[model samples]
Target: MRLGNVSLPVLASAVLCLGALISPAHAVPSQPWYLAAFDHVMRVLVNNEAPAVQMASGSAEQQNNVDPAYYSRVTKEAGTITLRGNVPSDGDLKVLQGVAAAIAPGASVVDRTRINPGVPNRDVWLAAMTFALRQMGKLNTGSASLRNAAITIEGVTNADDDFAVIQKKVREEAPKGLNLQVALKPHDVRPFVWLAQLQQGAVHLSGHVPSEQDKVIFGHAQVLFQNLTINSSMEVAKGEPKGWIEATKVSLEMLSLLYSGSVAISDKVVKIDGIYSSPAMVDLLKVYSKRLPEGFTLETSILEPVARAPAARAEDMSFAAHQARASYNP
Candidate 1:
């Protein structure tokens, strides 16, 4: 007999099997749509352990499979959108560039389509993208990857409320039997610093510093140099110097204004070795020297800032200023 123009026994059996498979799996008729990838991506969102803190860029690798399709969905929140490998027309990437552009007007969209055929887990491709998009929308940072129908979602977030929403949505959107991995880190907002050092013509700031103090130091430099290239090796850590915040600011200012010099501060010491910008700066430091925080001692040279003339033999402040220094024995 003719069944929808396909004709006979072959058509009947194919139709029967198709109906059976599609009932729970939602299999596609035109192409191989695997549920594994979709399930994997969905499961991670709702998974118990996948939550994070603050706002950091998330990443995912589309890999490891019996036969994996190289498709990835990345929502870089005001950064860029990246799509890689061969994605089905119905895949999440099909219209993702447009959608991403709409959401982040300046975000870049990169397409790297290298389709690998025979992937039966293609069905979940869109689900994976949608999941990533939702997570990114809430977390403002997230990534998704689908390989051999497996899904991975990752992000960094700070709000417990948002984490809860992500958890709920993940569970609700993800179907069962998914291979999902959720990687999220919690945000920590504590103040800390270790070493802040500036030297030569360039400012080299290393170690760690409290967020607030970091702002003052860097901010002051910005105002003075206008175009300063700071070699920053500092990080936000868990503690601060005995009285490091104010001392750090003064240290930075002294370095930025000097013709060429170095300033280094730690828990135990605040040492400066440089030529002062002017006699007034040296006086200024002497005036406020006592105002430096309690954690560190200040050790520096003193000299009148003389410029447009010559590079003096040594960077120490002028002898006249030194003789007048409060510590002078003579």
Candidate 2:
């Protein structure tokens, strides 16, 4: 065909046409499927409160069941994602399923790490945890009512074997009389002789029982611990924690909004204002506190509901069906 002043040579045209007919079509570019799948998995894990997600430093393995079309490539390792709270085995399995469904639907564990079986001296362990939790800002320091309070340890188990191993390891690592017990125990079953819950917040503290031996050992050592107590709390005048959404709008991001407000700390309530963010959005704030005497262990599992953005709604999926129909049509 001739257009303007240029004409296509018959031989060249024929060769071009033949090449188009014989060569395979290029594949469509897809968003990194594994990233989306992993993101979803992480969201579920975080929502369910996992302590950690251990991955190889740079493994490129992707869960099989997630839709490969949403991501371009998967990282070999997602890194270890630690959950702030304890995750039940059943809950963990559900998260695994959620990840599988996003990538390879039928994929099963290729390899796995067995749960560690060990128990530490409950009294000693609780004391250590109490000390650590207090340092982490989870427990409150003042409040006479909280003193001598009874606390129930939930979510985590105190295994016999684990305790034995810890004791053995401590003895082996430290000189004799160095592994001192710091946790206070009552004559009764309760391990804490002096523990108090915040009347209005998530913070709790064990009564201070000065041990001369513990003072001697810890006086000059540099040790760190995880603090898992609620630092403050806030009241919701309009929005609630359940209203948090994964969007930019203030209405959609209620948690972030609430966190920006003032935190009121008192005997009746301790309000904490803080930010919560993920890869998709930024500057999320939330107000949370634990209800205790109701439960213990410092880490309160506040059940909050989440909202979805209208733009991200799954109902707006008709275009995908139309595209599939057009592609499949004869």
Candidate 3:
């Protein structure tokens, strides 16, 4: 007998020689070579079996209980939408085709998908696919992919305005119960600046912010100033300096400390100018600056209340002390 060109007896001899070279006791542990060969085989099987049994409990997943791998990808190029990947049924395939057609009415659909049964969370998967295709249609040439429960959309558009609009939509209208990531290249603006000004029960926010960092600022605003009206005119742009989000959060915190003031961050410099009724507020500002992350410089122009008559001065000082206490607690 032979395995292709190598004869069986030659193969057996090579295996025996190899086993002899690797044996723990130098090839021949016992009187008979057959016994040594048997020992080597048993040792190999036992060593491999032990690790498999040990790892079975900790690392092995039950095959029958595992969720089906569902994948769907959509790409648009040269006025054509190409749909690819696996769907649960023919109905889902048609639905995805229809979705693509609706998203880009003038473009043709190229279906290259397979029917894959047992797609877990069918409705959610379909919704995510539709959302992905719509976002993809907005781009001149772009791609969106759905693997299991995560969707990623990355591409470019013709105009900066269109890119900004798509980014806002993705951030605001992503499907629930799925992790959606967007990486639309944004136009870079040099000297990235953000401003928050507080006056008369309202805070006006303007300037530039990264796509995801907007939510952070909004969350902080919602909690810090429940009564104040938030008027934000922030635009989406890339090129945020180091420690951008951290510095922004710190700026928001310091802004909350003022009776009326503005926090303007341009590039890596944070300028905080406002009025505080207490001298203690100045000390508080200094402390906040100390905790600011590296690569940031803080400049403050906080003002104290104007001088008045002796009685008014005393009362103002008392109110300032109370304000300082409230700031610490709040």
Candidate 4:
């Protein structure tokens, strides 16, 4: 049977049987374990001291007003790091904290209001932020799990805005399950990335800035995939010239068999070939035309997935299947 564009090989009977054998207990505080696994997966995908190096070319384009370089030393560095298994240490925490501070330096909490009284709203906001940061590669997931396991931020001031207040409340209620409603209105100068992974072990990623102009110029930019069988669709929403670029309507397609190791991803690689056009793209180009180097223009296309050795064990699969079970059972 096929779901979306990918095929499924497992029999319904066997799948149900395996499902039954796996108790909800298998779904307990595996957050730490999942974090470790996710960190390993990212290590394999983006190996380097600074995984954000890929942005250098774009940075140069924005600064020097030149045609952005398509590749960088960081890309090769990531390749080397992924091969060496030199995962970042807890010291990376300081590095990420510095990044967070840099992203929102001088930006105050402003105000805080309670959205959910039953749960620790502050903690939930923080958790969501942490999830966002981890998704952006600013924070090492493994390191975050370790730090958050015991540490708690207290007495943080609340914000006036809904998102800010929500984030503040979530942060205040830390070290607990996040069950709160909060909103976040990060100021300008925030750096981030959009990441999408599938149950079949495929991953799709892109980088963007908060500004609308930046999003228009870079949002419809290059997309990188880790495996091919899965298909992903991403939408880019550019905020004000200096606000956040949001990705919505993101989806992926893949065969369930890949998660069970019954089908090898390398053998079933599929290609996505298409073109995307948007008024935003044209407007962004016009706004940045003078800033761009001669012969430079905004374009969008699918990038070839980086090749890596397959996981050696079932535990190494990307979080799709595990997360799916957790989402349904949790």
Predicted structure with the largest lDDT when compared to the true one: 3
lDDT of 1 by residue, 11-73 (tens): 545655656576555666554344343333344444533344111223332223325444555
RMSD each, Å: 19.2, 31.0, 20.6, 28.2
By descending TM-score, how would the candidates be arranged?
Answer: 3, 1, 4, 2
Q: Which candidate tops TM-score?
A: 3
Cand. 1 Cα-lDDT? 0.54
lDDT of 1 at 182: 69
Better of 2 and 3 by TM-score: 3
Compose the digit string of candidate 2's lDDT tens values, residues 140-183: 11100001112221111121123223333433432232233322
lDDT of each: 0.54, 0.25, 0.75, 0.29
Better of 1 and 4 by lDDT: 1
Give the lowest summed-lDDT range of ten residues in model 2.
138-147
**Candidate 3: deviation at residue 130, Å?**
15
Q: After superposition, how far is residue 169 of candidate 1 from its true place, in Å?
A: 23
* lDDT tens readout by residue for model 3, 1-330: 555697756766776676667657654445546555545555545455645554564433433433566788989888889889878789888888888888888898998887776566677888899888888767767899999899999877543454467778876777888888887876567778888877667877878888767777988887888988988777777788988999988898888887776788888988876677466777787788887789899887676756566466555444543453343211
Task: Give the runs in model 1 whose Cα sits over 4 Å from its true position.
Answer: 1-201, 211-216, 302-330
- Of 3 and 4, the candidate ahead on lDDT is 3
Query: What's the TM-score of every candidate structure?
Result: 0.35, 0.13, 0.45, 0.17
User: Which portions of model 3 miss their true places by more than 4 Å?
Assistant: 1-153, 157-159, 162-164, 167-185, 307-330
Model 2 lDDT vs. the true structure?
Answer: 0.25
